[model samples]
Each structure stands twice: as C-alpha cells, then as structure tokens.
Target: MDEVLADPIDKFISLYQRDHGFNYTLEQMHGKEFGELLPEELLPSLRVYLNQKGFFRDLKVIPGAIETVEKLCEKYEVFIVSAATEFPLSLEDKQAWLADHFPFISWTNIIFCGYKIVDVDIMIDDRARNFNPKIGRHLLFTSPHNVGLTEYERVNNWAEVAEKLL
Candidate 1:
C-alpha cells in the first residue's frame, strides 16, 4: 500500500534541478520565511505540475518497500499512515489526489490524520519524528530532503529497507 509520500516530490525536485537548474530543498520550497520562490497557494499546483511533467514517471520505489510490506503483511496488519497538508487542498481534493496517484492502495486502510501515531507494531516513513511512539520498530526511509535525520534505522533505498525488515 503506497502513501502520499515525498518520493514523487523528491523526483520532482531532482528533475527540476537537473533540467531547470534550480537548486532548492523541500523546506525552502515550503518554508514560511524563506519560501518565496513559489507562493503558498501555488505549492500544491506546482506539485501537480511536477507530477504531470514526468516527475514520478519512473520513480524507483524505496528499495525494500514492496518486499518488506509483502513480508510484513503476512505477520502484522500493515497499512499506510500519511499526513497531507490541509492547505489549498480541500479534504476531497487531497483524497482524490491520493487516490489517483495510488490506485493500487486501499483507501479504507489509510489514515489521513495529522499525527502519525497509531496502534501498530512497526512503521516506516521518511520522517522519523512523525513515527508512532507506540510502534516497536521504526524504519526510516532515507530522503534527500531528510539528510539531517540520522538517528533511526536509515535505509538509503527500499531494497535496503526490505533487508532490514526481513
């Protein structure tokens, strides 16, 4: 089950940087004080533009996401836990976007709440800080934007992540 993760966003960033020669981080793209290149209202539109412009066309799923989730689903009840900004997106639009991008995922199992904590055995996310405190194991997906996070079980790719989970 895929989530509304920054992988698509990350792909956009890299493509934007490589093709347009704009070097910017996600924080800078969304930061309150420093996020001036794009207006707040345009952020979501920009993301959509990026998505449409082949930003996620050939994105490599985290190395181990498929295998790990496939394996874990056999033991624990695995589900997607995501937090999307309630900005210009109405709840419906956000849900629609998630649904369109991840048609293979089960919307019933998705939790679109602000906080990431849920009664679960394990959780994997790009943001380690948002992990559920009640979770026993925290698998951190390494993101180019999340380089400052170094305390968790950081895996550079999904394949590495699958190795750790298995």
Candidate 2:
C-alpha cells in the first residue's frame, strides 16, 4: 500500500518538518530510507511518529493510482496487500484510508500482515526484498529506497502501471 498506492513519505516529511523544522525533498531521499537521512539520535523519534495513531490515515494518494487500479480491476483480481504488522497502530488507519480512496475494492481483497507470502502471478511493490523471482513477474514500484535497484522491471508512476498492465 505504501509508496505503491499511497504516499507515506509525505506523511513522514510533514511530521518531520513540523517537529524538527527540517524539510526534505524527494531528491534528498533518493536511494535511501527516510530514517537513514536523520541523525542517529532521532531514529527513535521517527519510529514514534510512525507508531502514532492516524499517521497512516491521510497520506496522499499517488497520482493516477485510483484510476489505474480501477482499470486494472476490470481485467484482474485486484488486492491491496499491505505489510502492516510492523506498525500495529496503522492497521486500522490504512484500512480506513483505503476505504475512503479505493471504495471499489472489497474488504476481503485486503491483506494486512507482517509477511507478504501470497501467491500471485504479478506483484507490484517498492521493496525488492519482497519479491520472489521464481514465483511471479515482479514489478518494482519506484520509491526513494529502491531507486538504485535495477534487478527488476520498474514502474515510476501509476500511469506507467496503466500502460503496462491495463
């Protein structure tokens, strides 16, 4: 759900800037996780922000995501799989966010768990580690942390996703 359909980094940036007065551009985050850009002492606080209630509720939807995914649904069984166990507090907010933004998707199609072990013919995610090359065609959704990665096919935006999948 994160970087793929929703802009969680925006949430992180908003809270980080409001609290620390340091604004970060996406370019500054290229090829690195958001925490890696912060001072070591501030790492714990970053985790705190992620754990706070409503942190995942209002993330901006990625451009073209809703329209593209809705189009894809016409041809495929769509799912909103999220790795939510890591931040227990975000489970509810993520669900609510999805409901508000992607109401066409059914609740039964959403999966919130620690491990993404679902068997699918194609998987789109920002994290390269989550891909099992032998299992399916994995499309790497471009995100700051995965910018340097080149092992898989990459889609930089939802429009690209529509062109490729729809």
Candidate 3:
C-alpha cells in the first residue's frame, strides 16, 4: 500500500513540517526510513503520528497507479495486500481509502495482515523482506527507502509497472 500505491512519505513530511516547521524532501530520505532522518527524540513522535486515527486515510495516490492497476485487473486477479495489523487503527482507514481510490477492487480481495504470506505468482512491493525469491517473481517498487536495493527487478513508477505487467 504505502510507497507502492500510496504516498505515505508525503503524509510524514506534511505532519513533520506542520509540527516542527521543518520540511524534508524525498531526496533527503533516500535509502532511509522517515524516522532515520529525524532526531532520536523525534522518532517516538513520528511513531505516534502513524498510530493516530486517519493517518492513512488521505494519502496521495501514486501517479498512474489507479489507471495501471485497473488495467492489470483486466488480465489478472488483483489484490490490495497491505501490512496493516501493526497499526490497528489503519485497517479501517486503509479500507476506506482503497474504496475511494480503487473501487473496482473487491473487498474480498483485500488482505490486511502483519505477514504477507500469500500464494500469488507475482508480488509487487517496496519492501524486499516481503519477497520469497523461491515462491514467485517479485517486482520492487522504487521508493526513497529502497533506492539502494538492487536484488529484484525494479519498477520506478506505475507506468513502468504497466509496461512490464500490462
């Protein structure tokens, strides 16, 4: 969900700038988690913001995501699999967000769990840890945190995903 279909980093930057009066650019966050760019004392506050209600509700959708995913659905069984159990409040927010943004996807196809243990033949995610190389083809979605990673095939944007999968 995050960094793949949604821009959570934009939310992080907004909240941080609104509270601390300091803005952070995506370049500043390259190859690092948002928290890693903050002062040690501010890390806890970032975590708190993530746990707050509605944090996941209005995230900006990645460019071309809706159109590309909609196209992919024509040829494949699409699922919006998100690791949401960690932030319990986000489950409802994410579901609502998906409903608003990607209404074509069915509720039964969404999976909100801690571990991404699915039997899909192809998985598209920003996190490399979620991929089981032996199980399927994994396409790494480019994000600031995963910029340095080069193990799997990488898709820099949704257009690239469309090019490769559609």
In terms of TM-score, the best-performing candidate is 3
Task: List runs of model 1 lying over 4 Å from the truth.
Answer: 1-6, 14-64, 85-105
By lDDT rank, best first, the candidates go 3, 2, 1
lDDT of 3 by residue, 77-118 (tens): 998889999999999999999999999999999999998988
Cα miss at 26, model 2 (Å)?
A: 1.0
**Each model's Cα RMSD:** 6.1, 0.9, 0.7
Clashing pairs in 2: none
Off by over 4 Å in 2: none
lDDT of 2 by residue, 1-166 (tens): 9999999888888888999998888889989999998989999998798899999999999999999999999999988889999999999999999999999999989999888888888999998888885656889999999989987899999989989998
Best by lDDT: 3
Question: Which residue pairs come into collision in candidate 1?
Answer: 62-158, 63-157, 63-158, 63-159, 64-158, 64-159
TM-score of each: 0.59, 0.97, 0.98
- Taking the tens digit of each residue's C-alpha lDDT, what string does model 1 give over 1-166? 1222424555555655775577767666432222255546645655555335333344445444555556656666667665643333433444554456554456776676676658877777767667766788887765544666667877667667557665
Query: Which has the better TM-score: candidate 1, or candidate 2?
Result: 2
Quantify all predictions' global Cα lDDT against the true fold: 0.56, 0.91, 0.93
Clashes (N, CA, C under 3 Å) per candidate = 6, 0, 0
* lDDT accuracy of residue 117 in candidate 1: 55
TM-score of 2: 0.97
Model 1 C-alpha RMSD vs. true structure (Å) is 6.1
